[model samples]
Structure formats: C-alpha cells, structure tokens
Target: MSDVLLFSAGLDSFPAWHYLDKPPALYFDLGHRYRDQERAAITALVDRCGIEVSVSRELDLSRWEADNAIIPLRNVYLAMLAANRAERIWCVGVKGDATADKSPQAFRQISQMITDLSGRPVWLDSPFWQMTKTEIVAWYLGQGLPAGNLLLTFSCSRTDSAATHCGRCSSCLRRWISLVNNGIDAPFETDPWTWARVADYYVPAMRDGTYPDHRAEEFFAALDAVGFVPPPPAHPATAEDGQR
Candidate 1:
C-alpha cells in the first residue's frame, strides 16, 4: 500500500517525506497560495529522494483572503481529499512542538469525519506528531540530508512572488526564530526583514500573564531557551523577498 503526504513543501513536510517508513507516493496539492521556493524545494526533493506527486486539485473555498492564520477546517478538507485518492496510510507532518494548537486533536477530528463520510478506514499518520523542531532537524541531519536545502522549504502564510516570505508575518517569524534557536542563521538572511516584529509580538505576551498556559508556554520557553534575541526591525524590499 502506498502512502500520501499532505505536502505543502514546507520545512515540516519536507522532512516528513524523507523520514516516512513507507515513502509517500502522492503529494496532495490544495492549490492555495504557491511559492517558487516551495515549488523548487519540492522538485529538488522529488529528484533527490525519488518521491512521486499528484498536483493541482483545487480546494473550492472562497480564496483565502484574510491574514488570520487559522483557516476553518483547511486540513480536514485536505485530509478528506487525500483519502479519496489513496486508501493506505495518509501522512501529515504536524510537528507537536510546532503545531501546538492544531495537531492531534484537529487530525483526529478530521479522520473521524472522513471515516463517517467515506465509510472506510484510513490511517492518518504523523510520525513527527509528537516531536519538536529540534528533534526533526536532528533527525534530518542524522539522515545526511543537505542542510542548505532545508532552508528552501517555505512556511510563510503570506505569499509574495517577489518576496515570497513576508518576513513580518507570524509564520515566517516563527520559522526565523526556530532557525535562530537551533543555532543556525535562517537560510533567508539576504532578505531585508528581521525577526524583531516576531519577537516583539511574543515577548510581551510572555512577560505579561496573557500567554496560554500549555503548548504556547512551551513554544515561548523554547525560544527563550534558544536565546532568540529579536533583531531591530527592517522593512523588506517587497513582501516576497525571502518567500519560497
């Protein structure tokens, strides 16, 4: 039986492709926003690792128009789509440390709905579901994958062709801080934006009694443990500068 990946060509999913015991046979593309870095990274990953892909199945939603990171039930819809195409295990790279609010519970809820709707058993696998970014990166490094390409995977929610990563956005900021915490300069150093806005946004939440008590605490604590002093703010040349 073949496996399918809800592949976004992001840092989380890329290593999932590499690390799955039964390597993925198809990549379910939601046709949301596209980034050149993601495209390039996927192409390179497929070539280097010999994974197959199925692309461009549209998610018929009112185009994601808002900046709010949470899109209502996006993963659930995507998981259902993947289930239709493959009956075997369907893997998602929902990292435990990264996806604090939306990992196991979200996935379990979706799987239950899919079984009810489709009337079949399908496995929703998340090998890295309980692992931290540090653990994932260490796994990748141990596997002898090139660290250079790791930076090419895109995680930015805001898409810009010219500056594919809106470095100021929450997603980009988290990725940047994650890289810094890992003691590695983010691959997008040439981009004009810095993690100052990201740090500013969270540090206050952390200092005040506003931050959530659970995974959010672990998230911020990990950043603090990693010594991610936010840099001074700088505007990117364009929103797409570091995107991909």
Candidate 2:
C-alpha cells in the first residue's frame, strides 16, 4: 500500500511532494471560495511533478461561513478518508499553529481512532512538524526545485470574482511575509497595509465586534519587521478600507 498525502498545493505540501516519490494526493474543496484557484494550482503542480491526485468536491457549505473557509473537524475527515485508501497517511503539521486539529495530540488521537475503526494500524506522519514555513521553503530551494514551482502554490483565504488572492486576508499576508523573509521576491498582489494599520483595524474591531480578530492580530504582529506599505498619508481618509 502507498502513502496518502493530504495535499493542499501550498508551501507546506511542496517539500513533501518533492521528497516523497509522488505519493497519492487528496484535495478537499470544502466549499471554499478559492477552491477553483486552489484546484488550478494543484493541477499545474501535478502536471509538473507527475503525481496522482484525487479531488473531493464538497456539496454542503452550511457548516461554515462562506467568507471564512474553515470547516469544523476537517482534519478528522481527511484522516478517515486517507485511512480508507492507504494504511499510511501524510500531512503537513508545522510548528506554532493555533489549529487544535493539527496538533501532535490530535494526530495521535486520530491515528488511534483510524486504527480502531479500520482494524488496521494506519500511520499518520508529518515530516515538517518541526520546521517553519521559511525553513521549508529554504529546504525546497536547496533541493534545486525550480523557483517557478513556487508560483504554482496558492495560499489565499479569500478570492475575488476572478479567483485571485485578496492579499489582505490573514493567509495572504502570512504567505507574503514568509516568502519575503526567505528572500524570494513573490509576484503576487495583495492590498497594501502597514503593521500599525493592521493592528489599528483589528484591535478596535476586537472591541467593537466587527471582525473576528483571532489570527488577524497575531499574523500582523508577526510581520512587524517585514510589513511594507506605501509609507505615510497614502489614504488618510480611507485607512479603514485598507484593512479589508
């Protein structure tokens, strides 16, 4: 039996795809707004890497908000599905993440749950658990993977009508920061915002209850050194709109 990878065509999965001899991959749509964009990226990567992929188109969007693309217990579904196809499953659970499902404890518990139900020991592995996103990209670069392959990955939380990265979303911001910090000049367009403005927008929203200020504050805070804006009085009146 071969290993099954819960692939998302992003930085986390890139190294796994390169190192793992083209493991079978599974992609979940989960009714996300950027699902089409994700699929296109995945298709391009697959064409380049020659890996087999299975796509799951989700029908129900009722479980989560349309704007916020997190599905509750998504890892559980992925693990169980992977267990059905292979005894060993691979995922990218990196360091310092708030998501409870991606934790080591959660992975162990899910492995046990899969074994109990399937009557077979299913191995759930995350090789990049100890590495950060920047480290992972560095590893990929050192491996001589074409830098052009980097453009095939997508990490935007929100998508426009054209299925492009919103760039203002937390995911886009973090991806941009990771690439820039790693010395890769990413050619993606995101809405411009300074770290100060991100805090100014989210901190008050946390108080007034307009935006879900969970990752917004934390991500922007992480980008303190690298956050680049137009610098000073770019839009004094519409600074609020820049947060969007």
Candidate 3:
C-alpha cells in the first residue's frame, strides 16, 4: 500500500514530508484558530516545492475548539479520514511528545482499529518518534534542503495575523528550540529567551526531570548559545581550599 502524510505545513510535518520519501499529503482545514496562518504556509510551501497535497475543508472542527486550541482526540479524526487515500498514514509525533493522542500506544491502537474496520491493514505512524524536533530539522537540512523553505513552515499557536512567530507560545517555543539548536536562528515577533514561560515554566520544568534529559540538555544548550542562561558559578571550593 502507498503512503500518505497528514501534513500541516508545520515545523514537524514539513520535514516529515521529506523524511517519508515525498508521499502524497492530506491537509485537513479543521477551522482551528490558526487555520488561516497554517493554510497560508501550506500554500506558500506547496507552490514553491510543487508537492502533491490535497486540502480538505469538509470538516469544520471549530465548534469543538471554541474554549481552547486543543481539539481532543483530533488525531483520531484526522487519521481515520487520511486512511481513505493510503493504507500507510504518517503523522508527526516527535520524541518528547507526551500527548495522549499522539503517543506510540495510541497510534498502534488506532491503526489496528482502522485496519479492522476498513477490512484492510491501515498503518498510522511517525518516523520521528525517536527523534526530537531539533534532530528532525538537522536531518532535513542534512538532505541539502534549503533553510529558507523550512523557515516558511509556521509553528505559531497564536491567533494574530502577525508576520512573525509568536515566540511565547508553546509551539513557538518548541519551534525556536529546534531551529536554534540546528544552527538556524529564525526571528520571532518576541524573543523566545525573554518569553515568560522560559524562565518560569520551561527552565524549571526541564531542569527538574519533568522533561527528558536529552531534550533538557538541548534546550539548555540553545539558551546557552544566546547567553540567556547565566554561566554556572565557579566550582565551589572544597575543604582542600582551606589548605590551599
């Protein structure tokens, strides 16, 4: 069976298109808050790259996303519909992703369910499950793809019609982390280092083992790159210090 990717023109999905051998993609305009932004990016990239991607606006999932950007079980709906085109469905699930719907277990269950119901083996998977966004970007660039094109991918979670990324949002922050670590420091509307979440949430959360160790190191490294995080104090003098 052929493969199809559930593309969103985001940091993760854009690179995934390349990783999966340029499979046909399906973009579902679910009428979310940032649909316009995402759609614009999709259009820009598609025109530039000439990739075959079908945009489906048949489903308006906006009603479910009224109070929050998160549409619960959204992946389930997208995966089921994407199976119509190809038995192998590629969804972007990164290494540190903890979302219930995007987890490995969830995909396996969903794939099996879809296969049984459709009377055919439909597999939904992500090739980046073991790789973080930063590594994914590195791989994309390693393929000799243009950085300008990847920059065209949008990862903001804001509702504004801004020309730059809202670097404070979780999506934007993660995007910044990936790009910064990959030696491509794309500009954002607000400096991601100055984002309140970095100091109050991400720094602490990543430090306290809430986030994976590797991810934390990369994040700290990114912060270190811009000198956002202060250097650790000189090694504390041991008891031998008194002798010295």
Candidate 4:
C-alpha cells in the first residue's frame, strides 16, 4: 500500500510532504472561500517542485469554517477521502493540537473505523503531530532546499495571493509565528503583530500558558523579533477567553 498525504499546499502540509520523503499527495477542492487561492498556491508549488500530487475536484465543504476559522470534522472528512487512495494516509497536524478530528487519539480512531468499515487495513497519522509549527518549519528549511519556494505556500483565513498574506487573519498570524521563528519573514499585507488579536488575545493567552509552553515560547519569540511585547504575566488572558 502506498502512502498518500492530504496535502493543502499550506505551511503545515507542504513541509509534511518533504518530511515524509515526498509521498504522493492528494488535495481536495472543497470549493471553500479560499479554494481559488489554495488551488493556485498548490499549482505553483507542485509545478515548481515537480511533486507527485493531484487534486480531487467538486467536493464542496464550504462554509464549514466560514464563520469560525476552525473547520469542524475537517480531518475526519479528509482522512476518509484519503483512505480511498492509500491504506496508509498522512495528515499533518502539529503539536498542541487536540482538535476533535486531528489529534493522535482521533487519528487512531479514524484508522480503526476505516479498517473495520472497509475490511482493509487502514492507518492515518501525522508525523508532525509532536512537532510544533516552528519546529516543523526549521526542519523543512534545515533540509537545504531553496527557502524562497516556501513563500509560495498559503495560509490565510481570507483571500490571499501567493505573494502576499492578509496578516490580520488567524491563519496568517499562525503562519507568521512559525515562519518568523524560523527566521523566515514572509510577505504580509499587514504586519501580523498589528493584527489586533495579537495584543487583545494571543499576547495574554500565550503568556498565561493557555497554549503549550513550546508553542508559547515560539509565539513570543516571533513577536519579540517584531518588537511586540506582552502585558504583565499577572494580567494574562484566561483560557476561557478561548483561542480566536
């Protein structure tokens, strides 16, 4: 059985392709709001790298995460679809992710469900599950590949071009945190630190240890590089404020 990645041409999955020794990749065009941008980014990357990846069309999973940035059961849908291509499926999730559908426990459960239903051995996993996005980016650049190509990867909540990211969005903020921590300052239409969430939410939340320590360390370091500072530790944002 072959290994297939549920590729999205984003920060996480793009590096995952390399970490997995360049496995065959599968991208689903869910016709979401950012599909056009995502498809374009993927096309650019694959064409540049000559990667063995293909797109599956017309599977519209739009509006699932339109209002809120979190895509509900997104990994579940992707895992099930990927099983059709390979009994061994690779879905890239990062450290500190215990999302309902993207955690290690969740992946094991998906694998069991798929195996039982198909009566065929199926296993879904994320090699980067234990690695934070910053660590993953460092690993990717450490591969000695041309770093410029990584700029082609897309991670934006709103529409973004291959060259510029909308810095205000959570996806953009996350991407900036990872890339900046790796000393790769990507192009953003607005400085990610200027995204009000950095001051109003993330700063305090990260300081209070609402996020994993490793992640918080990287997050603060990235912001510090850009001259952003958090409030006093005593005034940390409560975890109940939620991750926005």
User: TM-score per candidate, in order?
Assistant: 0.74, 0.77, 0.91, 0.91
**lDDT of model number 3:** 0.88
lDDT of each: 0.61, 0.71, 0.88, 0.85
Residue 23 lDDT, candidate 2, scale 0-100: 78
Candidate 4 least-lDDT 10 residues: 156-165
Scored by Cα lDDT, where does model 2 land? Answer: 0.71
State the lDDT of candidate 4 residue by residue for 1-244, as single tens digits: 7889988899899888888899999999886777788888898998899878888974667767646556788888888888887889998888888878888999999999999999999999999977998888889889897778889998887753344688988888889999888888789999989888888888778877888889788888998898876666564577876775
lDDT of 3 by residue, 59-173 (tens): 8888888343788889999999988888899999999777879999999999999999999999999999999888999999999999999899988878767757888788888
Please state every model's RMSD to the true fold in angstroms: 9.3, 7.2, 4.8, 5.0
| Models ranked on TM-score | 3, 4, 2, 1
Model 3 regions lying over 4 Å from their true place = 66-68, 230-244
Ranking by lDDT: 3, 4, 2, 1
Best by lDDT: 3
Worst 10 residues of 1 by lDDT: 189-198
What is candidate 2's CA lDDT for residue 146? 87
RMSD of 2: 7.2
Poorly placed runs, candidate 2 (over 4 Å): 58-62, 191-197, 201-244
Clashes of each: 8, 0, 0, 0
